[model samples]
Target: MNRVILIGHLARDPEMRYTPNGTAVTTFTLAVNRPKTKEGVEQQPDWINCVVWQKTAENCANFLRKGSKALVEGRIQTRSFDDKEGNKRYVTEVVGENVHFLSPKNQGNLFDEPFSPRPPVNINDDDLPF
Candidate 1:
């Protein structure tokens, strides 16, 4: 019920850090454009917070940069904590499980080679019949 899928451009390079327990974590914002216009004017872009952990986190930090288009699949997470000023702050983020490179057309490729999307895997469950 918490799943989320997003395809957008990165607003900036990921901010990567390691937890005290030594787990790598990366956070970034994705700019998703609205498909529709408002009153004949373009709508403002939507910025979504995304996070990745461990190997995924490292890969994100290494390969992704500002303005890079991305496809991400993850689950929604929200947490709250008290800041130094004692004000409670709440943030929502997508914890990434899958990431696909989608660099922008205007900037050109960072890597010369093209990458393809993964092929779908056929599923045959015993509960389902043809």
Candidate 2:
């Protein structure tokens, strides 16, 4: 199966564009953290290239920004093309079938009220199932 699932923060703002046929496409780089090395040194995050299409592309472009967290479900696709230098280049990227916005609702809002803790709920000891 050519399936891939990634959860990461966007390294930069999503770039949206349209194909000649007017199909929407969005591209972004995801910075996914890698596990520490055996020596316990933190490794640099892996930068993954991702692509989304259609309405999902539009939504990703609208809601996701640099540093926004997201979950992308897709498949790994690799393609080759001739570059301007006349050299063939190969690129591998995730073609997102679904992109879920994982950032807080008011994450990038500047005018939103400061967050306040909710009042603690009072429950009787009898409510415990344990």
Give the candidate number with the greatest TM-score.
Answer: 2
Minimum summed lDDT over a 10-residue window in model 2 is located at 109-118
**Top-lDDT candidate index:** 2
- lDDT tens digits by residue: candidate 1, 1-130: 8898999999998899999999999999999987776567778899999999999899889888888889999999999999999999999888899988877444543443457565798877965785
**Could you tell me how far off, in angstroms, the CA of residue 113 lies in candidate 1 after the best superposition?**
5.8
- How much is the lDDT of residue 20 in candidate 1? 100
> What TM value does model 1 have?
0.77
Where does model 1 exceed 4 Å of error?
A: 38-40, 104-130
Off by over 4 Å in 2: 109-130
lDDT of candidate 2 over 10-68, digit per residue (tens): 99999999999999999999999999999999999999999999999998888889999
